[model samples]
Target: MYRLVLLVLLALPLAGCFAPRAEDTARNWRPMGANGLALGRLVALSPGVTRATWEAFAGIKGQTVVRLAAEYDPVRAAAGCPPPEAGMVRAARSFLIVDLAVTPQKSVDFIAAKAQAYSADGYFEEYDLDIGVIAALAARARPMPCADLALPGYLR
Candidate 1:
């Protein structure tokens, strides 16, 4: 009886390891804020693909965005993609504006294509609607608030 109880206790812990993981269910669902964007929308918007496929694509795109956002400096400098006249803060905000205007499929395609091109050439030189999307997102970014010296230290 003691041996059986011991075996059950050990198996109980291992059972969790065998239990299905969320990744197995929602493959493309990235934790939010990974790239300051929600990639699962791509799966939700796409037609014909199974949920699993869409989830996988979303995961891939999320990782791609994170990587690209991190490597943006090198690509921007190398490709001579116009120096952001408004600054990267504005450019980053521009992504929100661009997201509002484009369909998920289009956004996914744009990112995927750009990532592919970047992977091959170490730059993003091809111009398309995506360029306009980036510009718009930058243009629409909210400016930082002016500092108020009169305000209390915490409020300021």
Candidate 2:
């Protein structure tokens, strides 16, 4: 019985190795409780003004907001813009509260054309979005980290 107990203890550590690594799991991670809808990966497709308006709309719709930013060193780096900064890195402690919605390709195309015609620096952020769209996206937003929000059992 003692030998059996010792073997069980030894096997317990090995059991962990069979489980997926955190990074591996994160790669496949989808926001929990999003039903069939999913938030697209955030990209730097537009400028700051657009981001601000989108954030305002997102607030009204109660979507999960991840204010993300990055720093870029145009020339040889200085003290503030240190090394290992070849590309964008998440900006220091900045976040914009914003609504997120998926725009239909048709709408996106139309807006792009209009911007080109008018020679606008960029288009209004929420030009293609509405409250209903924001709500839909919000419904699928992953629960904010470390906050309990009456989530579904699976998510909890």
lDDT of each: 0.28, 0.25
Off by more than 4 A, model 1: 1-10, 25-28, 34-42, 47-156
> Which regions of candidate 2 deviate over 4 angstroms?
1-14, 32-156
For each candidate, how many residue pairs have backbone atoms clashing (under 3 Å)?
A: 3, 5
Q: TM-score for all predictions?
A: 0.21, 0.18
Give Cα distance to truth, residue 140, candidate 1, Å. 19
The alpha-carbon lDDT assigned to residue 148 of candidate 2 equals 13
lDDT of 2 by residue, 3-110 (tens): 999999889788774554322232222333335222232212221212222221122233223322221121211222334233323222222223222122101100
Instruction: Compose the digit string of candidate 1's lDDT tens values, residues 94-126.
Output: 111111212223232234212111222222222
* Candidate 1 lDDT score at position 92: 14
